[model samples]
Target: MKALFISLCLSLLMILSSCEGRTGYLDEGQQNTVAMLTDVEWLVVYVDYSISNEQTFDDETNIYSFGRDTKGWTATGSLKDPSIKKDVRYFQWTFTTENYAVIYMAGNSTDGYWMIEKLTPDELWVVITASDPVLYPNQYKTYYKLKARKRQ
Candidate 1:
């Protein structure tokens, strides 16, 4: 019994050690793609997804606003359903030094994060990917993948 217990402990340690720590996933070029992601202000081009019933619905409802911080450098933006309420909420987001990035929204804030899975400068498009949040953080949070064109 003691030998079995020791084996279980060793196995658990090995599994945890294998968990990779979070690191920026950007390449040099991809890093440039997001340079302005947290720089200039971004307006809502479209919201690619919304959470409902543990399901993600691609919501192209362009009736929204999203922008990066100019000063404090915090993730700042507001979202609303004009059909319902038009209140913008301030939230925090994380931008990776890597090409891939995420915008975290949780609490009275927003309970989740949005990751930029892909960005194409030539096409002027960004592909964001996120997961549905269930049973809290354990389940993937809602994904608000956004494909936006720089606003002039």
Candidate 2:
């Protein structure tokens, strides 16, 4: 009886030790993504619209700040173009449980879901898609891509 109880205790201890650093919710990759996102301000470097074939290369002044509280702000403007007025917009964002690569954003200017194509310490690329001919004129589906780089 003593030997059986000692074996059971050892097994329980091993099981608990295995879960020591586990968050039980977010995996390591997801935690890393969250860390990278809230690390610094990101500057918009490129924008592309699929239906219109419109591409805009930003002057690296359009900034995006993601906070740990899941709130963020975007400062839109061009450093090279004096005619472009600077605009600040606030938004709430969260990753979907079904797919962490997808982010849902709701704000005054941004209201949609965006899929992350690439994410690194210094670069991020995301795409938003809308599929409605009536709403999105020229094409059955419209895709908008935004590329950003971390601000120094």
After the best TM-score superposition of candidate 2, give how far the Cα of residue 137 lies from its true spot, in angstroms: 18
> What TM-score, over all chains together, does every model reach?
0.37, 0.63
Q: Over the stretch 1-152, how does candidate 1's per-residue lDDT look in tens digits?
A: 99999999999999999987655355666457556464333434333333554222243232222443312212323323223323445554554324345444443444444545554442223333334321133543333333333332
In the predicted model 2, the residue pairs found to clash are: none
Query: CA lDDT of each candidate?
Result: 0.42, 0.67
Best by TM-score: 2
How would you encode candidate 2's per-residue C-alpha lDDT over 48-135 as one tens digit per residue?
A: 6555575556463566777878898777665455344358899998886434777777887876666677888877776664422224
- lDDT for 120 in candidate 2 is 82
**Could you tell me how far off, in angstroms, the CA of residue 121 lies in candidate 2 after the best superposition?**
0.6
The collision pairs in model 1 are: 26-98, 26-99, 105-110, 105-112, 106-110, 106-111, 128-145, 130-143, 131-141, 132-140
Error of 2 at 150 (Å): 5.6
